[model samples]
Target: DLTPRQVTLRDRTTIATIVPFSSRYGVPPTLLQYLSDTMNKEIEGGDTYPMMDTMTTDAFATYWFQNFGAIMLLGTYASASAVTEGNDWATQCLGSFYIKPNYTGRSSHISNAGFLVTDSARNRGVGRLMGEAYLAWAPLLGYTYSVFNLVYETNVASCRIWDALGFKKIGRVPGCGNLKSYPDRLVDAIIYGRELGGPLDEQAGEERFDKIRFYLKYGTYPHGADRAEKSRLRSAATHYRLREDDVLMLKGREVVAEVERQWGIAREVHERGHGGINRTTTTIAEKFHWVRIKETVSDVIRNCKECKDKEAAKTAVVVPAKRKLDGAAEEYLAGSEAAPSPALRGEQEQMVGAEQNDEQFHVPASPPQADKTLTPHQMDGEPYYTSLEYSGQTPNAFQTEPHGDLAPVHLHADAALSLDPQIMGPMRDDFTLGYPQLHDSTGQPQFAEEAFHIGGHEVGRGRKWEG
Candidate 1:
């Protein structure tokens, strides 16, 4: 296929390619004979093309029509005069190639293409230029991918050009063929492929302009408008005829943010002054279609700490008033007193009460006893276990020990098991083991001595003498 546009290389050389038409170019038979002869010479060399053998002019033409539906004639011109002169026009005939769906039928997305540059055009960047043109045309022809099937490893120039053009080497078949230039030595064949998305790029550009087209037709922004206004906008859009000059192209949000950073924020700071909100607002309004341009500029400058610091530096420094600070501290204290902490009702009050009295105490006592000195025998019960019984019980309920000599069960007063002991002053209440039966059975109080002592004096004993 022939491209409608021409490509100019980095060296300022313009190149173009087309399929030879006898009626159009008026080329003499001699030029066609020379092009066919030069192509066969390159194929016979065997360093680049995989022809395996050379062909005569008629055989090559027949092979070209059978393999490729089209052929490309690449021409390089140094000046416009050479093109119009039509003699010694410096042209190359790219060989026919077969590229199609793979055998599996799943890789129909990619089209395989192969070609060799003419021997006269070798080392002149003609291959690279042709490859670039092929890639550009492949996408336009509805092909999403293209692959070079057999790039010999010995051909370093071709490989370098492909690599520079962003083609990835997807595969390598080691020692695939013998090269004539390398004296019967075999070289690996490399496969290079590239994804084509040129058409989709054009589609994306069209979609970007769609938003601007909508705004131009209706003369109103698309978003943040009410239903009544939208109805009126639809009527306006129906009658409106947009001119080319009315196309106000707006960018996406990300591009807008970048523009604000570079132009709006950075420029104002570099210009050595806070140019006021109105100036910044007008500067942005002239260029962009922000949803709320004034608010957006105000927010960007207001939140910028650097801008604030610069503005502050230009003004006089004022010392903080001592009385104001003192008044603020007093206000905070009064507010804290007004709403007491929840902890003051329960845990905090208990902690405060404990601190006020010198008497020793324990808190959150473990299960079975708040009284630390009480033993299992004194409670008249067996030891408590959280797990299953040794007799294979499921631990659903308590079971007494099957012993005949077990002591009678005793029920202690709830007050005796309280975790917190009441405290009044510098002394505690006389705490006693209130087991009357144990006292009567032993003929003496079991806890005759005090559990606590202070200042080397028995305090809060079975009987109390002082507070």
Candidate 2:
């Protein structure tokens, strides 16, 4: 049996008194020969440990002890009689493996390792002991996570050990394993993984923002003595030096986007109104700092269906355009046809009532006409237009036969027909009069002799206008 009578590190310091168990050099030659021979015998026909199919014992030992970043094992005490017979062995060996993250640049992580147990150590908890040790040491060795790539489906013992130790079965590969007992038959390979420190929360375990945070706190670069990186870090630190939480702040792209998406949704739905991009951006900036927050908010609002629907409803409310006349009768008649009809008065009333104020008009008794000139009178403290006196019969003197395509008759200013003051009541007082130089289908100045009120009142008709 093999036992540690004295333990010493490379420095010759006696660690046996401090360490609970004995530590030794890497897998010895005899142990490697034993493990290699056993793997070849037990795993050659089966699909387990396929990498060892042609590897020599020396090559196997070199690979594990030299190539691997770290090595661990399960040591069992043997009787003195067994050592005297020149026969002692390590129950199992577990080695740590690492690969470049994404097969690219450097990373502070590694993968779960595999182990080999001697036939005599089967069901003796030797595999479990090595696995537990691996879990404990992986984090200390700077591996935050570990993934078991191939656990044969038939290897129920190893699977159970992993599961009981908080490892989760994440996925499986079908027809990838060959059972030792059924070497001709293929089986599925299961993948298992677990975070040594438990699953990370949102933005947890992400170091993308760490550099910025460090610069914010120290007002200097964290690492990378390179001139370019140092310059960049210095620039970034200056930009954020005035910030209150610059040192502890997180400014990653995905991180900010996630926050904006959440807060934007809440503001849009919970706030007093449909607070759009402007409001959302402002609200988020008050709590968190990020550049281009407006752009992020705009993107969120663009995809929001409810806001789009509300905007569409607002755009659908339409007002009819005022009609204009021409010197030619046919052209004037055509335009008049497009004007809102008296037949639709009921529908117009219903719509106008819903949209306009109840105090729109305050029409009093109509006054008798006394003269041709217009006089303004105040109603509801606003000026209004009243009727003009007419002593003669309604004259048709201004009416002329339709002259085909005659040049538009531009009336002189003296012939201006004053519009009813009531027509201006609903509109703002500052509104510009659009009557001058009114064009017809011929695109020439138009002349008219009639005046109508918006309330269907014909205030002046058959009056001559020169302008």
Candidate 3:
């Protein structure tokens, strides 16, 4: 009757017997400590700031165990040992589990988590093994998919493992995490996810698993370095494969040489012909014709005016000598070296002295009467005194030389030629005046005009003249 008399509501719920806590109810303190320690270590080691600590671990464990029943407890138990192996392993194992449900309401597929491990425990298949285990377990925990919401882009090892696990990248946050070894260089945070219950063939799953294992062992994907190296090698090989002949052709070497040779031959042919070369008429094929060169040169030699004139003079008919006009005239005429009479020397002595006086002092005479009877050629050729008209208007007096055949005279028109007293007078009087003088072989003035004329018209004092 001691307890049966009035059993209180609180007493009723409490049993008198010693009831032990279920083995499932209480986790091993060592395992809990390990999980907490591993998670804390991984979060600290990660690139992101404001990481989880002991308090976070306790909160996560309380929420997970409270809501999800025995499943969460079992997962916690399994993940504890995995985390002790390495940071990567702990991240992969615990990264998929959701401690708080409905994180994004309707879009709760977006999940974020991390892992922890000592440095010495890496590269031993621990990270990959845990990743595979998580993929296998995620669907049973009512998760449609698992996501690595933030992963540093420069974390090559972590990226390789996740990619090999068939986790497709969905998004990226630029410059969200620190690049390892380069604290100042921020890296992109990569978002990755994989469907929990999506279509997955056995072969594809096996292939993916195999790839993860390969990455763990070799630390690279298929065709990574080889692909890049092969492309570089191909480019180099293409560059070296070009032919020397093709290169010469592209530079037009043969074409340029052919053009130069043609030009040389054309110049030679034109010279041999003695015909003024017509550059426009010259052709490549014509330049190489030896027969044409000979023909043209022969024609030029046959028509030479200087040779014809010399031959005509040499073959002229002879004329007999006439009787002497008087003894004085005879002596003067005979005084020549070829004289046939003795009387020529006495008369020639008187004439020679008079000619010497004429050379010493002379004056220009008045214009002569027009010789209307003479031809234009004869009128032009005759001396000025003999050709000038008394009326100051000789017939065709202003006419140019016949047939425009005036010889090309070398005229000294340089500024130094102005030193002549006669030239300096006109040049100083009219500052724009130019004095041009015909030069003899010895560079002395042969002929000069006080006021110049060309083409029968007087040139104005200041006008430019083209000789």
Candidate 1 stretches with Cα past 4 Å from truth are 13-32, 65-109, 198-467
Inter-residue clash pairs, candidate 2: 1-78, 1-83, 369-389, 411-466, 411-467, 412-466, 412-467, 415-465, 415-466
Q: Indicate which candidate wins on lDDT.
A: 2
- Tell me the tens digit of each residue's lDDT in model 3 across 375-409: 11112233111111124432222222223322121
* Cα lDDT, model 2, residue 214: 55
Cα lDDT of candidate 1 equals: 0.45
Off by over 4 Å in 3: 1-26, 46-60, 63-102, 109-113, 117-121, 199-467
Instruction: Choose 1 or 3, whichever is better by lDDT.
Output: 1
**Per-candidate TM-score against the hidden true structure:** 0.35, 0.32, 0.32
What does the lDDT read for residue 258 in candidate 3? Answer: 23
What's model 2's overall lDDT? 0.45
By TM-score, highest first, what's the ranking? 1, 2, 3
Worst 10 residues of 1 by lDDT: 392-401
Those runs of model 2 whose alpha carbons end farther than 4 Å from true positions after fitting are 1-26, 45-47, 67-87, 90-104, 178-180, 183-185, 197-467
Task: Encode model 1's per-residue lDDT on 1-467: one tens digit a residue.
Answer: 43233432222233444332212133334444555676687688877776777787666544443323223345543332232334452444442232344323676667666555554454444555556556666665557887777888656556655655667789987777677876644677989978876322211111223333455655565543457545655664554335565543433122232223333543464345557678876755565443334644554565455776788887744322222232322111223324335553344344344333312321222233222232222222322111111222111111112231222222233323423222222232222223332233423323232334556654442311111
C-alpha local distance difference test of each model:
0.45, 0.45, 0.37
| lDDT digits (tens) for residues 1-467 of candidate 2 | 12322212111221211011112134345655765676566566564654535678776555544423323233332321222223354433322222222112354475557566566545334444455555655565566777888887555456545754667779988777656665555677778988865533212211224445555555565443357656666665544433464333434222332332444544454344658767777766665654345644564565445686788999775434443334312211233425556565445544343223313221122333344532223456554433344433122211222332111222324334555454556533422213232233443333344554456665454332223
Between which residue pairs do clashes occur in model 3? Answer: 42-116, 86-117, 87-116, 87-117, 91-115, 331-343, 331-344, 332-344
